[model samples]
Target: MDELNLENEHELLNSLETILTSECNLHEYIDDIPQIFATDNLKTMSHKEETNGENIETLFDKFPMSSNVSKDNTNEIVTLKSKCEELHTQIERLTKEKEEAFEEIERLKDQILSQSTYCTSLGAVLGNLTWRASRFPQIVDTWLSNFQSKIGEFLSIVNGTFGAFVDTYRSAFPPTSNVEYQFVMGLLGIVTNISASPEGREFLITNSSGMEFVQKLIKLMPELPLAPGTVSLKRLMLMILYNVSMNKTGLQYLLESRVEDTLSHCLDDEASSEEMQLLCLRVLQSVTYDLDKPKYIHNLIATIPIEKIEIITSAKRSDISNAAKQVIKYLQHSQKITK
Candidate 1:
C-alpha cells in the first residue's frame, strides 16, 4: 500500500508539470486545467507552479532587445505626432496668407473704381479747363509734352471710357445713367482744341505714339451710329478727322485706316446734319485729290453713296453743294476708269 500511494503521487506530479508547460505555451490552458486539479493540495501546487512560470516569462519580456524595441516604438510615435502638429500650424498660416492676398486684390479693384468715378465727375469742368489751357501756349505745350510722355496711360482711360460710351449708345442703356458720355465729351473737347492747330495735328497723327491713339480712335468711330442723339459725338469725331486730314501724313494714315468707309456711312445716314454732311463730303473730296492708288479710288467709289451725293450737288447750301460736286466728279471719273 505504501509503494502504490508513492507511485500515484509521482504520476500526479508528472501530469501537473505537463499541464503547466501547456498553459505557458497557450495562456488559456491554466484556467481549464485548474478544474481537473479540484483537490485543495493539487490546486495549491498548480497555482504555485503557474505563479513561478509567470514570473520567469515576465523577466523574458523585459530582456534588453525587447526593451530597446519598445523605446524605439515610443520615439517614432512622438516624432510622428510632432510632425502632424507642425503640418497643422503651417496649413493655418497658408490659409491666412491666402485670405490677405484676396483682400488686397479687392482693395485695388475698389481704388481703380474710385479713380474712374473721379474722372467722370471731373468731366463736368473739363471744357472750361481746356479753354483756359488753350490760351496759354506754355500750358498747351506742357500739356502736349506730358500727353506724349504718358500716351499709353492717356489712351487706356480714353479708350475704356469711349468703349463704354459705344456700348451705352448702341444698347437701350439709359444715356444719362452712365458717365461715359460726359467723360468722352470732355476729352473730345480737349482733343478738338489740340487737333485745331497744324502743330497739334502733326503731334497727334505724325508722332509714333499719336498714331496709336489715332488708330484706336478710328476703330471706335464706326461703332457710333449716326442718329440725332449721337450726332454731336459724331460731329466731334468728324471734326477731329477733318482737322487731322489737313496733314498729308495724317491723311495717308486716315486713308489707310479705311476712314472713308466710316465717312460714307455718315453721309448716307440721313440723320446727319447739313454741317455733318459737308464735313464728310469735304473729307471724301480730299481723298479724291490725294488718291494716287487705283484701289483707293475704287474703294472710295464703292463706299460712297453716289446718287445721294449727286443730289447734294444741287442743294441750297453752297458749301455742301460745292463739296458734294467735287466728290461726285471724282466718283464718276473713278467709275469710268474702273470700267
Candidate 2:
C-alpha cells in the first residue's frame, strides 16, 4: 500500500507543473499586445460583454496598434468639416444677391409712378391746343400739318386728348346753333369721306373699335331738338345711318332696336306736300332695302296705323304710291308664311 501511494503523488505533481507553465506563457503574450481597436470589432465585443457579463478589455488587449489607420481617420474628419464651411459661405452669398434684386424692383416702381404723372400733365396741355384749333379752320389746317410732322411720337397722345375733349364739349352747344352744327357736320363729313378710302374701310371692318361711339351718337339723335326747316337733323341722321349700313353689322342693330318705328311719327300731317312725301318715301325705302327680311318689314308694317296706309294709298303722288305698294307686298308675304 505505501509503494502505490508514492506513484500517485508523483503523477499529481507533474500535472500541476504543466498547468502553471501554460498560464505563465499566456500572460507574457497578453502583456506584449497593443491597445488599438477596430470600430466594427469593438461593437461586436461590446454586445458579447453585455449579454454574458464578459470583460471586453481583456479581449481588446490582444489586438495590435496601427498609426497609419489612426492618421487616415483623422484626415477624413477634417475634410468633412471643411466642406461644411464652404456650403455656409455659398448660402450667405445667395442671400445678399436676393436682397439687391428686391431693392432694384422697388426703385423701378418709383420711376414708373413719376413718368405716369408727367404724362398726365402733357396730355392736358395737348387737349387745350386741340380744342382751340378745332374752332378755326385755318388754325386746324396748320395744327394738322404740325401734328403730321411728329406723327410717330405723338399720334397716340393726340388721339386720346382730342377724343376726350370732343366727348366733353360737343354736346354743350345746341344742335340748332349754326356754328355747332357746322362743327359737328364737318367732322362727320370728313369721317365719311375717309371711310370711303381703302385704308379707312379696312380699319372700320376689321378693327370696329369705334362701334360703341357710333351707337352712342345714334342714341343722342332724339335729344337734338332740330327743326326740319332750319337744320334738317332728320336728313343728317338718315345720311349717318346710310353710311354705317355699308356694313351689315350696324344695320342689324337698328333692326333689332326697331328704330323704324319712329319714322311714321316724323311724317307731317300735311302729307300732300311733295317734300314731306319724298322724305317719308326715302326713309321707308332705306329701311326696307337694307333689312330685306320679311319679319323686319312686317314689324314696320304693324307700327304704321292702317289709317296711315289708307292715306298713303289715296295719295296722288307716284312716289307715295310706290312706297305704300312695297309695304303692302311685305305685309302680304309675312301673313302668307305665318298661315
Candidate 3:
C-alpha cells in the first residue's frame, strides 16, 4: 500500500514539472488563443501515468488536470498584458499632447477676438469707403480722380501748399485714426499712382497750374521745420518731384528752378534717410538727362564726390544703382568742364 502511495506522489511531481516547462515555451506554441483552445484536445481529469524502471513518464500528452492552462492560453495572457501596458503609455502621452493643443487653440482664439474688436471699432467710426478699415488707401485714389475733375477747386482748398492739404486731410481720417504718420502716407498714395500713368503725366504738364503746384511744393521744401512730421513730409515731396521729373517739361522746370544744387545737398544730408538720397539721385538723373542742359550737369559733378557716385554705382538698392549708372554713363562722354 505504501509503495502505491509513493508511486502516485512521484507521478504528481512529474506532471507539475511538465506543465511548468510547457508554460515557459508557451509563446512558441500559440498565435490565436480562442481558435487554438476551441479546436484542441483538452486534458481530461482521468488518471494518466506510465512507469518503467521505477520512473514515471509525465508530459503534455499524458497529464490530466482540466483546470491547467494550455500552451496557447498562456502565451495569449502574456501578449495581452504587454498590449495593455503599451496602451497605458500611449494614453498618457496623448493626454499631454491634447493639453498643449488646447493651449494653442485658446491663444489663437484670444488674438482673433482682439483683432475682431479693433476692426469693429474702426468700422463704427469711419463709415465711408474712403476710411474703411482694410481699404483706406482707396481714399487717395478717389481723391486723385476727384482732383483731376476739379483742379481749380482742389487747388483753392489747399491754397497751393502741402501743409494746408495735410490739415484738411486730418478731417478725412479724423482724430480717431490715431496715427500722425498716416498724413504723409495719404498724400503719397495719391501722387505716386497718378505719377505712374501716362495720362496723369500729361495732365500735370498741360494743366497751367501744374508746374506752379510743383514749384510751390519745391518752395515749401526749404521752409519745413526739422521736426518728425516735416522730415517725412519732405521725403514724400522729394518722391513727388522724382516722379514729376520723368518728362522733359518737368525736367526743364527742375533745371530752370536750379533744384540741382539743392538735390545734391540732399544726397549729402545725414538727417534724411537712404530713400531720400535715392529720390534725390533720380531727380538729378532727370535734370542731367537733357544733355542740352550742361550747366545743371556741371553743378552736379562739382558738388557730389566722384567716389560717392562710384559707391552708388554698386549700391545695395537697385533703384539707386540704376539712377547712379545713368549719371556715370552721361559723364563718361561729356565735355571737359572745370568743377
Q: In model 1, what is the error at residue 108, expressed in angstroms?
A: 10
Query: Over the stretch 1-339, how does candidate 3's per-residue lDDT look in tens digits?
Result: 233367767776776676566545443333333332353222210011112101222343365644344557546545644553454354445545656777999999999999966764553344232223213445444555765666445433323435554554433433424333453345344444555555555566556666666776666565544455555656667866877788667777766776755776676667877777787787777666635446766665676745677877787888888888887766644534422
Model 1 agreement with the true structure over 248-278: per-residue lDDT tens digits = 8888888899887788777777667788888
Between candidates 1 and 2, the one scoring higher on lDDT is 1
Off by over 4 Å in 2: 1-177, 191-210, 226-230, 268-280, 289-298, 305-307
Kindly report which residue pairs in candidate 3 clash with one another. Answer: none
Predictions ranked by TM-score, top down? 1, 3, 2
Q: Roughly what TM-score does model 2 have, to 2 decimal places?
A: 0.40
Please estimate how well model 3 matches the true structure, expressed as its whole-model Cα lDDT: 0.56
True lDDT of residue 33, candidate 2: 23
After aligning candidate 3 to the native by TM-score, how far in Å is the CA of 211 from where it should be?
1.7
Clashes of each: 0, 0, 0
Q: After superposition, how far is residue 232 of candidate 2 from its true place, in Å?
A: 2.9
Query: Candidate 1, 331: how far from true, in Å?
Result: 5.1
TM-score of each: 0.58, 0.40, 0.47
Best model per TM-score: 1
